[model samples]
Target: MVVREDSVETKHEAIELVLARLLRLGSLVAAALLAVGLTAMVVGLTGIAPRLITAGLLVLLGTPVLRVAAAALIFVRERDWYFAFFCAVVLAALATGILLGRAGG
Candidate 1:
């Protein structure tokens, strides 16, 4: 399809779209990481070695923490206050769990 220059939108709109898509992609990746982490943690906990389980839990927790920080950066740049706030809260909760898990271990 042939499009005219005047018929197209400005660079800023395209940039915004790109930023939002990037954020969405990040969110998806984070979600996947969290899921995998949780599964590994569960498997380790139920399996033979206690040390392995603890290590698995720690690694699993790290992925979400990383994801949240990355997402927050994107949200802040995009001026998405709501998303930023949500991710912040989620990160805090995950951190607390990590701390408690370590303490208990």
Candidate 2:
């Protein structure tokens, strides 16, 4: 059976959607790794336990910060409103986390 033109277009769109999601997910993972690696390095350099623990917590909680920051940069460059909104919310959460973590510390 021959595939219709509309069917091909729909398939192509679906593939693009999947690719975009994968790219975003990959970005999030990479950002998490970067934050974790940076924290680990700082912990290794400094022999302070509480500071190290704080850094670890910050890295863990800041994963989304990196993710959103990456997305925000992309959205800003591309002028994407919806993604920008997502970035705003994620950044707000990151800010809240920072405030709470500081207070607790």
Provide the RMSD of all predictions against the true structure, rounded to 1 decimal. Answer: 9.3, 8.5
lDDT per residue (tens digit) for residues 1-105 in model 2? 146645555544443454466556666665665566567666674445445456556555645555567667666554557978887887898789889999999
* Residue clash pairs of candidate 1: none
Task: For candidate 2, report its TM-score.
Answer: 0.40
Give the residue spans of candidate 1 off by over 4 A.
1-61
- Candidate 2 at 44: error in angstroms? 14
Work out candidate 2's RMSD over C-alphas.
8.5
Estimated TM-score for each candidate: 0.43, 0.40
- The clash number for model 1 is 0
Model 1: how far residue 90 lies from native, Å: 0.9
Q: Per model, state how many residue pairs clash.
A: 0, 0
Off by over 4 Å in 2: 1-63
Global lDDT of each model?
Answer: 0.63, 0.62
